[model samples]
Target: MIIHGNRFTLRPDADAAQIEEALESLRNQGRVIPSVKSFVVGRDFGGEYEWGATFMIEDLQGYWEYLVHPAHRNTDQVGLPLVDKFASFDITDDPDPEMGAKIAALHQRRYDSDATLTQLVSDLGEYKGSAAPGAHGER
Candidate 1:
């Protein structure tokens, strides 16, 4: 499965009601893609960022499906006009499915490691949306 961390900035001035409307809309939209195995949107209570949601996608294609879905396009309708963008980190495991827990633990460690400072610096050097740092010919 691929895990994508989506960050959105609701219209800077949007009130709590507007934010709820956007989140509720996503919840009510039902399944937009078959591969969207599971996803839940919620306010980012964490003080670090504005808002974010973790999506569990069955595959890259499934992630694309939801990206182009009409429901996603309507983000502005519910008052979330500013999409800070998304940070998608692929998670892969070995052959043994029974090792899921161990794999998750490893992945969590990777996520928590502060070594990402190097990546953060590199990304800042030439960041563009969420693609590669120096991917030319890309929008």
Candidate 2:
């Protein structure tokens, strides 16, 4: 699975409910939206994390498609008039489970720590799993 960070800024008139509805519709799509094995969009309920809402794309390509796809463009058509509400927009991608882990492990090893790096790596190494790494209280 590939993960893409897609942060959209809605027009000032758009409300949370409308944004929520748009995301819900996308999640139910049968096709025409590939690479998006799973997607989530919504307003923040509580706890930590930035912004009022966020979108998660399972496939970077799928997300790229949606980013330009008419399907999204059409729905967002209604929301576009309200776009000014947002302060910024952002999107990022990380490859599926296995590779992302190795990449993070490397980063954590290199930039995360030196004195603690060995111990941290060892602790993570203790886990025996084939799947990609999990979120570690990340943003």
Candidate 3:
């Protein structure tokens, strides 16, 4: 299985209503996305981030589906602007040595294909790891 996790800190100007809506959207994503085998989203106690989420997928295809799913994009639209800092990490048990690069490529392609997504990410205070724009000096 592939496990993808995202950690973020909301902007100071983010209101309570938007935060609740974004949290609900995060919860809805796991329920609506067929490719998500399991997921969780909640407060982060020990981490630097204020909130975090993890999504479990069966394989690369499922990961791709999770990435491109409308719910995921919707979550981005609602959540990205509220975010001050964002980062993602992926863990997989697959045997392929190139799996990490493949995952990053998928993210890169997603950002490349979606101008809105690229802009949302670019507007953030900071974004790190995986397919993050300029994470590898690309985009």
Candidate 4:
């Protein structure tokens, strides 16, 4: 298994809507990429970086596929401009006989049975569009 992690700070003028749009794009990318087993993104409070993302790929080939994917390329074009600074790393875990089963169980627990990446993107877009001022507290 390959784990890719990233931490980044968005530009001063970037707002939650822009952030969500980037996240939605990522989710959409994952949907089309078969190598992407699972992915997650989060916001860090009172931290040096504002956001982070983690991606789990099935193997090295999958990792390569993900890198060359058009959706992934779009992220570089559309998402990078909003970032102030960023750092990323990849970890290749040692092969374990039970890793596949563990990954399957973990994915099942983390994602809803009916949930699809498209739905997740849509939900994020909805939040971006309707979110009210101060709804998330100052900043």
TM-score to native of every candidate shown: 0.53, 0.38, 0.95, 0.62
lDDT of 1 by residue, 1-139 (tens): 7655545444456577766777766664445655567776776775544566666766545655655566754643453343333332335433555443433343333324434422432433122233222222122
Show how many residue pairs clash in every candidate, following the order shown. Answer: 0, 7, 0, 0
Put down candidate 4 lDDT per residue, 103-134, tens digits, no spaces.
33333332333244323323321111111112
- lDDT of all predictions, in order shown? 0.48, 0.40, 0.90, 0.59
| Highest-TM-score candidate | 3
Cα-lDDT of candidate 2:
0.40
- Give the TM-score (vs. native) of candidate 2: 0.38
**Pairwise lDDT winner, candidates 2 and 3:** 3
lDDT tens string, model 3, 1-139?
Answer: 9999999999999999999999999999899999998999999889799999999999989989999999999999999999999888888999999888888888987988999899999998988887586544243
Candidate 3 regions with alpha-carbon error over 4 angstroms? 134-139
Over 4 Å off in model 2, which ranges?
A: 1-32, 46-55, 58-60, 87-139
Q: What lDDT would candidate 1 get against the real structure?
A: 0.48
Which has the greatest lDDT?
3
State the weakest 10-residue window (summed lDDT) of model 3: 130-139
- Candidate 4 achieves a global lDDT of 0.59
Rank by lDDT (best first): 3, 4, 1, 2
